[model samples]
Target: MTADLQLWPIGNCQVSALLNAAGSIVWSCVPRVDGDPAFCALLDTAEDGNPPRGIWSAELVDQVEVRSRYLRNTPVLSTVLTDARGGSVEMLSFCPRFERSGRMYRPVAYGRIIRPLAGSPRLRMRLAPTKNWGDPDVARTNGTNHARYLCDAHTLRLSTDAPVGHILEERAFRVERAHHFFLGPDEPFVGNIGREVSRMCDLTIDYWRYWVRSLATPFEWQDAVIRAAITLKLCQHEETGAIVAALTTSIPEAPHSERNWDYRYCWIRDAYYTVQALNRLGALDVLEKYLSYLRNIVDEMQEGAIQPLFAVSGESELPEAEAEKLPGYRGMGPVRIGNAAALQTQHDVYGQIILPTIQSFCDQRLFRMSERADFERLESVGELAWKMHDQPDAGLWEFRTRSAVHTYSAVMSWAACDRLAKAAAMVGLADRAKFWSDRAEKVRETIEAEAWHAESGRFGASFGRDDVDASLLQLVDMRFLSPDDPRFIATFEAIEERLRRGEHMLRYDSEDDFGLPETAFNICTFWLIEALFLVGRKEEARTLFEQMLARRTESGLLSEDMDFETGELWGNFPQTYSLVGIINCAGLLSVPWSQMR
Candidate 1:
């Protein structure tokens, strides 16, 4: 089967893998999210008479049907393969993660347990992993009860109870009993593999369940909210507290559109929204961890414009390049690696940084509250926001060849100063509170004077322009203008008229670097839903939100973009920005918890 957006993701925060319908680990990055793809068959399109390599599959002999789903409230995936003769096998896949030694034990490993469900099912295991962006298959070495594959700088060892010859030679074997496989760092088995894998599965399930139970879900759509929340958490690299935009990269926004770009690293703007959505559900753990990432970025930037994106490790330099070896998704070609967006100047990041950090000072529930020292460091970011709130830069959309004084960047800059004022008051600093408040007022005045389009009686996307993009809908959400304000109301109406295409919302109507966008951006559509509900268009908002929910993959997750006409989801898989929209809209549109009684 060809690679598609309908893939399942299983991860333990450190590393993740995307599995296809046949329960094959088709795409995964070892070491870290930004590392090389160890199993990159998702982008493999060999034309050299070679069958596609870099996939791990347990081929059920004469398989006739397949079905898969996530274990409730957990990231563990279970797939059942039914053969033509009515025999079936259940494959359970997950990454080992739980509380161990009084701390979190999230390993960079994958665990699979297979058992016969019906008659004696025969299985042929295909465990081929590639290295250096699908350029060549990894050299393998085998020992008793284990096989090791050399993955460039590191070795990936698979410790399994199945016969080594069957796996090495791709021979069919009978599944008379249960089998366990642990693929992780090169290491010898320390304990009984069967007992350990089983224990890890139970512990992992318990960990996810207990985590979900702590969430304060809305009265409706609890299941969808839980799933989106879990997927968002999966996108985070907990070790560094950076949340990636998506799991897979180079999945085109539209077929053969060359819109594909690597999304494995963190975009400051995207991470802010991720933490904000999770924070609304009272999942402060993510916010707390992410605050550390922001703190490091703030410190490192002592004085400079913060880039739009960064490596999860907090390294600033991310040079873009393409992996010519692996053909693109569906053989589109030109699969990209590192993102070039890191080189762009996106002034809105200052607000994104302070937006989440302000919560640290205000929310007393957090274990580590922001102190005066933290506020002092944040003032540096605020100073930059104040300095460049109205300057021309690559707006939040990250326009490639053009730069404009985007309304969104100005409003976010205003928000940075505005929130700092509130945080100062929370920390009992009167002088600094007044200082930030004055700066915020100045930035607000600038936006009102420049972004407001008097002729159209609505705010435009950028200063002194007639374009109305979906981002203008965020004015109310950012609190730059009240929902009842006539300007915000007019802006929302104008944006809907221009960007709304059927049930989907385009980021903009005008042509971009790749010409006019053909598919609707998922996050922008969610923004519209929120705007619709906020403007008292309750029924219409609910209907549109339902349409988006229906478009989700069978796993109840969304990608970055979707074709409005075909309803085909495109772009990166399990996009955090898209998932954040799910959680935010569900929280807004659901019935109040107080009325549930």
Candidate 2:
């Protein structure tokens, strides 16, 4: 069987991998998440079982049974494969993420520990580290305990404790001893290989445990909350403070949908929700890093221009291109790399950029509170919001073929002005507060008048259209309308009738670039859950929330989309949007800690 995304993620925030159920390392990128996939077999069906080119698998010959799980509240993964004769081999995989000498020692690397579990299991180590999206094999030369693979200007070294001849020849051998392997940059191994890896493993485990301990998660759904939080943390590029939408490139949204897009970049809307979710868990590290990225963008766009997405390094131009070498997930072709949406004017970003900055102004708990300069800079963004609140742009759904004056975009604009008004008041600038407040109220008036489809008694998706969008569910979350408000209920009912598909929620059922959506947008489903809760359908909300949780992978993770009919996961792995849903719903549904005691 090929690799399924019932996978585990191990990373130090610099690099990550998705190990599938077959005990094979499937999808992993190098240098950074947006960089080339060194092991790209997750999408290359031509090399499914041919491990001569891209994979790292410890195959157990005559294998009949296999099982995998994370090592107890940690990101470290352990998998066991048993052969027909009850012989078994266990593999433990993790990328060491720990503090060393007053610095985080998270490298662009991975480490694995393999040993016999029962009956002297036979093993064939297929550590084929390829390059050019699995199209070329790197030239390798072995030493006594290490092998260096040279690919262009890059050199990767794999240090192992197993027999070098067995690894190079792809020969199976009966396990006589435990082995350790570390595949990383061309660097010398410090001290004994086995002892060093063991220590690193211990330190990594402790580090993750401590990080998990620090989370201010809700009382219930603790496992789900922790896993989601950790996954979101992995999505963060700590060096530049950019949070990616997902770790993968072109996993199609639906079968043959041709809607596949690269999601590894930092989207303003996606990042905002990610930081907001992490912020709720007291993960300010991600927020603080992302704020740095935002500050740079703000300086670059002194006139308040912003893109929908950017490279994690804050590069603005992410031109979309297809990789013909790799087949898409399940042979869905047109495997894409960069995203063109970076150039499209996604106006909702103006507010998303400001929303997090507003936190720095209001939160007294932060060590570095916002100064007058910060608020003044934010005012420029609010001015842009005021000017462009009703302008036509690529809406949040990012329709490639069309642009419109999206209601969600306008409401987000109103939110920016509304929040800035309060920030101004907090700083005792009554005049500025009134200025922003007036702008906010005017924006609100425009939304109420234009976005409302009066004959239908509902809020429409765009100014002139009578469509109900699932994004409307976010109106309550954004506090644009209170649950007690009649307009919200009517609009929500309209969405329920139009977008809800049994237990799933589609972003919209309308035909787009690839016809009608064949799956539910996972985050939108969570929004529906929140809307249900706010509308006093608390029981129904909890039921739906549980149903959504049931769809998560064996690793307690989710992809970007889910099949409405079969409930199968689709799109990219470890989606920040879906992870945010888990955190938001858990926080909303969990019984109060005060009452729990």
Candidate 3:
């Protein structure tokens, strides 16, 4: 069995140093974006997966103490371990430095593990890698002082400048005072990895510091907001403008249950909110790139409609399958990938994608003549929205077992048409403007008359069901109703009564449909923050915001769901929607309406 562990917070910083209870450095991912895992034991259990093939094992000592932290604002992670035998080991991981070429990009990763022997503790380091989710077809080749593991489409080379011996299980060992290992793909190790590592470390630190400096508010919760923002930024695939939902997937919503789903791809519905949050932070550059990415997808696809989600690089066909080989995190079975929701018809995609693109263009003041083609392209997209508005879609949740004419989905469809009408008028497409505007008005009338549940005094989840949904809270943020209107207040109270448990908010009760237990949706909690702020409850809003921020882990990470009963994180970690909520709420709290305009 693995030893007990305790994670120590690095001062007030958002980084956590994970150490065995006995005080040893076992696993960490740091320094560079997409760096190789230094301690990958967290990915799989010991019995079903191979351990790192290295001489560094805390089990060799009677007792150990380990601690770590980042070097200021940089991504570099530094860890130190001290053994009962008076021996100490320090490890550092960082990315190499490179100047960003306006078009092409190059990045490198560096890791160094150093140990000083005090009284012959007999140190040994083992290095072993299971290629492509621990498939056993890995091939290994020995180098002068290191080894290489190669498999189809993947290669890992470990080189050390110290004396090293190979073990029977394709591991490496060193008994000297100091040892270093360089690991990467078969690509040439170019551009002074060591110097680049130091320089890149400094550069990353400066980048984060400078970015955080631009924030207008250092509110009580600014620390958590900054960390969450940084993590969100890290999750963005720099090469492509896609923002993935999380770094890893298949973490169960309820331990030992099969509710785990892959979140490593971008979702269309998350586009507008994500861009809105970034735009509020004065990060127009990120919004611009993401909008360009959305346009690229529309430009490349033969069809006007969009999938629910897509790969970071715009790959459309992601086949869903189960990985029965490895036991899932916390024994959640049937780990899944390639979300099946992508195939579902989510009509909200029209508004979610286009409204944000239009918003970004307006926010960034990108009114150059060159932008006309992009504006025209969006107008073309609006035509597609007009066609989809009347169709029955899977709605926002992508319910698997049934379909309904979801009311929130229709509301967003109306929003798309309304934005398109504005865009058309702005560009002198007066005929198109009138057509979309008339259609939008009709939809709005239909929603207000048919979608509202008079008896319950709020918008229903769908025209078919009277149940209230957390999504209706968007009506206030989207400005579909006056905040102080009696009907709007009634709807807000109904949502709070039906969907909220204390400070935790559920998306909706799924017991009647999916048989899933009620859990807090992080995004919905932020919606409550916005709803409260809008409806003249500013103190209550700020109080709830702080409470939600406290729910984040020591490293300031939040998952998709939080267990209402235990306050434990459930579902996927570092969900994009959750981070986007944080950014949006922060903007509402920090920036005044005049400045926002």
Candidate 4:
């Protein structure tokens, strides 16, 4: 497996896996996003004189060159490998997802189709899976045309049209025609494997293209926005309607800096941003599903403070732990599995829930609209926001050992009250609207009095502090302040002076739980670009945006962090927050359709 973020993601909204440049399956979890990894070779280290385990690769004998790309508008990948003798083979990889039997049929399966492209090409297929987070190869039983891998949680069966003996022995064989492989839940293959997989592939392609055609894309960067949108959609667990932060965990923020944490679970803050960006593109399916998830969380909390995150299954308790067997990405040890942030107090989440729920009450296109009972349930959440608006907790950065009355949290709390009033007005509850508006005004007055730092001529990161962060750049987007407000202009200038490193931007200048951040946070840089455009620096904003677009991997996606000096990507792969940035900036900066016409 390769040791970088130059990877492509393919999923069916149920499970996801990362493929290296050579088309090897390096990182994937079985069953679900947070389940035990069946292909953990991305973080695996080979023993002395031993080949790497936990990988699935189809290698061409005497391979000379390889080219890979995604099928237009779909997650299906097409990879071609050429051998020294001018022989070539193409492989199509995907997970089946389409409507079947009047419902969506997305199983825990991986499909591959290999066909000869030119001359006779020899191929070797190796499929090795591990259990207990890279401990040992799973036990298996073989059939005439398939193999059953017995995992701890479930049994995975692989049925194929290729020679079973050649696959089991990992021996090279000639590819004269097409071959098919389907690895999924242990069950009988009902029909001809070749014909069935081909049909699934065609239907899957149609499904993705239909979805893409429905997106309201910006005139410029339409391809970038679509890929980012697809990537974000793949990050969600459709069963629970919970969207994850990224596909992989423990890919450190900086080399050996130990800033890695598990991101497979759903964070309230991250999901909010994902929906907001997709909503701009008029992708309401994602927003509708996420709203369902928020309602479940609100029903359970019933006025209690919500955690920053939860599992895809909506499991609230995620105690942090480490996997001892696997070494880390590029051998940066201490690979963690769960996140401890769930136990911390993050009052900002109360507002995140309210922000999205308000849409259902106002939108006319949804199948299910918010009703009086829904409004009552939301009131409990708003009451909690009012109570915790000025309380101390970890801020959006999720600082480990620090607690402060963060200005961002307070502003979000105000948003909770502010949006609730608007929703109440829409639902024809004048008394309730006035009640929430009064609370919002009180919270706003307090934030303005305390968060503004006259000495620095800007709003501080937290109340009564001189420090500023990239999140402060969100005042305009959050509707807390107008873009041209004098106070906001002063704060933007201060942040630009403190955080901008060349064309990139850091989250902050000061040290926190980790010593000093060695890489620029990708979303922070995008936030800076938006702020620049708002302040009438249009040309400068466009230039910096072009620089960021150039930095994305060949897959048209970005990670969580970037090295400002070397321009290398660090942190987790296919970060949803970073993808949200791409969509948000493209919408703001792209030429209007009216002008283009």
Candidate 5:
């Protein structure tokens, strides 16, 4: 088999991946983020299973060399290819930067091709825009410099800002020296093409650099930290402040397996650490935007009271569907959309959302009137926490097999109640403050009595299951246990003995529950770093932190999981929550608590 590289492009509006040369994979759901993938070649291998054909196609061509990179801190991606004829082509991808309002969603993909300085590259390029995940009959309109493809409610217009030759009917094209080709929906070709390209590139670079400069920590691994921060920010939905779990969907946990899932929604547990990282870096503008987005959606969540995840636009209805038109990545099966976990009762969400919001307010001093409304909402969340304190649910992992009374969820629930009490008192909601405080104490007492295992000397994964969970590391980060407490230290040691995979940590011991080959959880390992520091194991924490830094990819990116045996990255790439964990762990390890403010 040929060594094929697949680049799946998935974002708020686009679901596609470009392979080297012409082969590509694209998936899109109609109307909303949670809709099923229409182009799911990244999930299934059978020809009949693929959709939105021609969006990704391959043609015979001479030898070509390619190199790609993001333009310094910006989401703008640039790829350069050189053919055997000594001609070179540069491809650029970016979404337009603009402020949005109202309810409708407008997402456009902008791509431009440029010839090299020496001469025009004799190149054969094919364009296939799919509709309904490879469903046919895409209407095409020819223009002076570009072609427009429209299907259903989606419109993809390919226009060049520069003058170039066009060979209609055939998607292949050849360009002259010093010429540029621009393609996107609603792009004007009459304007100054050269100037527009230069300006967009410069603006995108400047935006990323400015945002990255906001970091306050000068840790030893500064480069890694900043890159991770940039990746996390890219996962953020700038319009609504919601941070997605990952950019891609339906990348199966195991090849040809039915475990593929959609991860493009905002997860409350993930967002808690995400906001904390941003807050620590002094990037509260985006953090506050996300908090407001959450505030807007909290009341709108109806089915399960409060879902674990939601669409970036705050839609609660995320129905699962399959895109049978596109072959899966590496032959994984059943590319899916709309996570069913949304309906699962994850009690930790209440605490996960509130404690982080409270921490952000305290750290950044962003207690504006709008934030006060968010605090009021926190009181209601506290009410939910009190009501569900004794109830059993699907726990933090969102296990598909069964529901259990997870101790970590209970711990966070108690923390939420505690943070709400603090926020209520601070904001002059005294009556409500007392109510939360009383409930918080009661819940804390309950957890200490029921959640702890005396013989094991560690918190269990759940009250029913005596297995230890990596999430219990939160006991230190949440300050639920005194760092020096013998029990916390014992728990840490127990986790190290049982769950540690070399230097990293696993989420738990249960193999059948998560439905994938067991691996070290990147976020949990980072949490362990904080646990070590809190327990006065500073040298040990620093050593472990350094080892964790070594785990990052050459580009300084971290994935969701790492193979315990081979130490290779598995699961989603550029996971926002994992990077947030790295940033937070680095901060706690390097800076003293008293000096943080």
Candidate 6:
């Protein structure tokens, strides 16, 4: 079994790290989220004769219990580990990232402060960061107050107010006063170490609190929604405005399922849902920044062609390969790095790309107003959607073994044309508006004719396949069909009967590359919840939504896959897709401010 880690994440957009419940720092990618995991023990389990490597742990001797929590509304995690003898140490951990000199100074670093809380607690500091996935040995050169770790191409320097020898030795020592440890790029730390960290901590805390205050959230699940929002915001690569799929890689969808895959790169479909849900809460900064990323990706596309996903830096070629690294999550082998799905033609990307840009034209809150040129550039994407709406390709599921014209992709293509029709009218282009409107009607009619399984009284997964997929719930959610439409209601009923396994929803019951799925995809369940809410099943939707929220880790975050029978969270962590569900459902179910007043 894998080490059951209830991870708490601390990040400043440029970088992020995860800390397990026992205060073991694991699963942080250096330089960027998609970079090599400097600390990767989250994916490794301790085996006999060999201790788990690539983890930073500060253990209090004879520790009996540990408690961890985020400070109020911030990502700053304050963990306290206590011994049976009543001695305890409090740890304040974060990646220092706030506005400095009117610029975001989010470095590839971590700041940790350890303090003696109770009696004298002996602490051991093990800072064994790894490089190149499997390689964990780094040569250390020590100075008076800092240790320069020269390994591979990267040089990491650790500066501490405490004795450098004590930390380098990984030996036990008594905690006297507050001790500060700063690990980042090799550079000389200026001024007093304690004072600098203290100031950064206070400012970071203030930055998070102030950022949360701007969110317009539901009264009942406000805390839950805010946590999800903060995590989603942290997933974005602030430098390039690109948001990653998740923070880690190689966490399998099910135990020994061989379904492990990396999720650090940005997918247009996932990022679309993420920014859209946050936009519901009046969080336009994410939308604004992502649009810039979108512009760059589109401008670089050859003949307006789009991929399912891309590297955060907009690199198009991501050749999927296995990392021969420190045993996988629980020693489940075949750790993967880059994703091959990037090379697939998922036609739904047209709508995913266009959906966020639609806001740019209409939302006056944005600084870069959409112009005729912007709409024309988007028309190129719309053309692809129109041409390929009925043609066969790898659908949204990214199936490797086979290809078909998925109903969901066709509907998304329809949405592209449909929205463009409205947007064109908004900009007073009557001729262009009617042109796209006619195309939208054609796509809709084709879907109604080809996708409907009349004998089953529901839509199938693809044109010829008589299989059910929970993603069809998006038909109503995406506005392809009205919530009260009989066709949608029938499809919803069909999905629940076939795909809903207790409180969870399966992406599909059919077998593909892997055998039948062992665990439910979390976002499919969220889509189910949203579908329920739209169909006037408010009570059922809220109850199921609550049950899903209960499945979140201790830190109130979720991974990509969940087991309905076992309640085990798998797949990549702090999944942007799952968090989008939290925000979307909270916004739907919460009583409006007008009603509250």
Worst 10 residues of 1 by lDDT: 1-10
lDDT ranking from best candidate downward: 4, 1, 6, 2, 5, 3
**Model 6 regions more than 4 Å off:** 1-3, 594-597
Off by over 4 Å in 3: 1-43, 47-63, 85-90, 95-126, 162-181, 191-193, 214-218, 363-370, 512-514, 590-597
Error of 1 at 232 (Å): 0.3
The C-alpha TM-scores of every prediction are: 0.98, 0.97, 0.84, 0.99, 0.86, 0.98
Global Cα lDDT for candidate 2: 0.87
lDDT by residue (tens digit), candidate 6, 241-356: 99998998888888899998889999999999999999888888889999999999989988746898999999998998887766788788678989999989899999999888
Q: Candidate 3: deviation at residue 33, Å?
A: 11
How would the candidate models be sorted by TM-score, starting from the highest?
A: 4, 1, 6, 2, 5, 3
Could you tell which candidate, 1 or 5, scores higher by TM-score?
A: 1
lDDT scores for all predictions? 0.91, 0.87, 0.63, 0.91, 0.65, 0.88
TM-score of 6: 0.98
Greater-lDDT candidate between 5 and 6 = 6
Per-candidate Cα RMSD to the true structure, in Å, reads 1.3, 1.7, 5.2, 1.2, 4.4, 1.4
The TM-score that candidate 2 achieves is 0.97
Candidate 4, residues 1-597: lDDT per residue as tens digits?
123778989999998889988898988898998989988888876756576667899999999988889999999999999999999999999999999999888889999999999998999999988888886668999999999888886678999999998998999999999999999999988799999999999998999999999999999999899999999999999998999999998999988999988999999999999999999989899999999998898877834689999999999989999999988887886789999999999999999999989999989899888988899889998998999998898999999999999999999999999999999998899999999999999999989989988887789989999999999998899999999999999999889898999989999899888898899999999999999999999989989998999999988899999999999998898999999999999999989999975
* Model 3 residue 148 distance off true place after TM-score fit, in angstroms: 1.9
Model 5, 1-597: lDDT tens digits are 112222423232232222332323343443333333333333444455533354433222353766656566555556666667766666665544432365322244444435553344655554555566645567877767777767565666666544323334444455464444444455455577666655655555565677677667555567767767766765677667778887667665443445567788889888777877877788776677788777877767554368888888887777877767655556564656678898889999888778766755555457544457667766777778878876898888888778878888888888888888888777778887888888889998888878788777777767845688788877877878887888788888888788877777888776656454466778888887888788788898889888777766544566677666666666655577778877887777675556547
Q: What is the overall TM-score of model 4 with all chains considered together?
A: 0.99
Candidate 1: stretches off by over 4 Å: 1-3, 47-49
Clashes of each: 0, 1, 14, 0, 25, 0
